[model samples]
Every structure is written in C-alpha cells, then in structure tokens.
Target: MLILTCPYCGVDAEETELAPGGEAHLKRFGPGASDEEFRDYLFARENPKGVHFERWRHAHGCGKWFHAARCTMTLEVFGTYPAQTTKPPKAIREAITAKRPGWTWREFE
Candidate 1:
C-alpha cells in the first residue's frame, strides 16, 4: 500500500487516508473560453503510462491538499510538494531524476 505523509498534519498516512484529486496544474477554461477549449479542459485529460503529477488530499488527516509526483506504471511516488505552485519543485524533480534518470514531466525537467 502507498504511504503518503501529510505535511500539514505531520501524519504518515496510508493510501486509504487520502483521496485522489485528479491531475494538478490544470488551466481553468471558464465563461470567456471557446467551446472547444472548455470541452478540452473538462474532458481531455492526459493518461500517460509513465510519470505524472497529481493532486491528493489528506482527507483523513489534515484535510489539506498537496501535489504528488508519481509513476503511473509502477505506482511509485517520487515525492510531494505544496499545491500552490503550477510546477513541481526542484527538490522533487531532483529526487525523480536520481531514481529515474532522464525523466521529464510537462514543463519540469
């Protein structure tokens, strides 16, 4: 089972203690956006086979949401970061690089 540490509550929670919040860093397409753009924002989500960034909530703990870098294929969590940013932090990126060299996710290197 995956273990996620909630930075706010300081709880090392199991997967059951958290809730998946889908892909993070999504650009909201609202009222003024074109129909196609709105539709794509709502439905066109990337489901890649490898590394991906997602949002997770510490539902059973602090109830705060955070970002996580994970591998879809292996279910391995690279690291977690604050949800306030649109891109993964440098430390998390370095950790992923150390574990899996040549890894690239979106605008992160």
Candidate 2:
C-alpha cells in the first residue's frame, strides 16, 4: 500500500484515501499562449522509470494538495511537501540524491 504524509494535516494517508493529481511542477500556459504550448501543457508529461514528482490531494483527510517525490519503479518515497512550493524542498532533494545519485529530474538535480 502506498502511503503519503500530507504536509498540511501531517496525516499519513493511504493512496486509496487520496486522489492523484498527475505530474507536479508543470509550466502552465494561459491565454495568448501558442497552440503548441497549450497542447504541451495539457498533454506532455514525463513518465520516467526512476524518481518522479507528482501531485496528490488528501481527499479523505485535510483536502489539501501536496507534492511527493518517489521512485516510479520501486515506489520508494523520498519525501512530500506543500504544493505551493515552486520547487521541491532542499531536504527532499537531498533525500533523493542520497538514494539515487546523479539524479536529475526536470530542473531539479
């Protein structure tokens, strides 16, 4: 069972109690943006086999959204942080680095 600790309520909820919100740290495009940019924003996503960042909502708990870093293959969670953050927390990055050296995801390394 996959368990994620909600940063808002500090509750370690199971995946069944939460809702997956797709990829995190996406570059959103709004009005006046090119059609290609909009398409990429909506459809383009990274499905790496290694460490990945995702958005999760604590539906059955605090109802707040947060980000989680974990291995897609192993399901080994590095850490979780508030979704309001523009980037992963330093501690989370460090934890990922400790487990997977030379890891680089998007702009995070």
By TM-score, the best candidate is: 2
Query: What TM-score quantifies how close candidate 1 is to the native fold?
Result: 0.88
> What are the lDDT scores of the predictions, listed in order?
0.84, 0.92
TM-score of each: 0.88, 0.96
What candidate 1 gets wrong by more than 4 Å, as runs, is: none
Model 2 — TM-score against the truth?
0.96
lDDT of 2 by residue, 34-106 (tens): 9999999999999999999999999999899999998989889999999999999999898988877898877
In terms of lDDT, the poorest run of 10 residues in model 2 is: 100-109
- Pairs with steric clashes in candidate 2: none
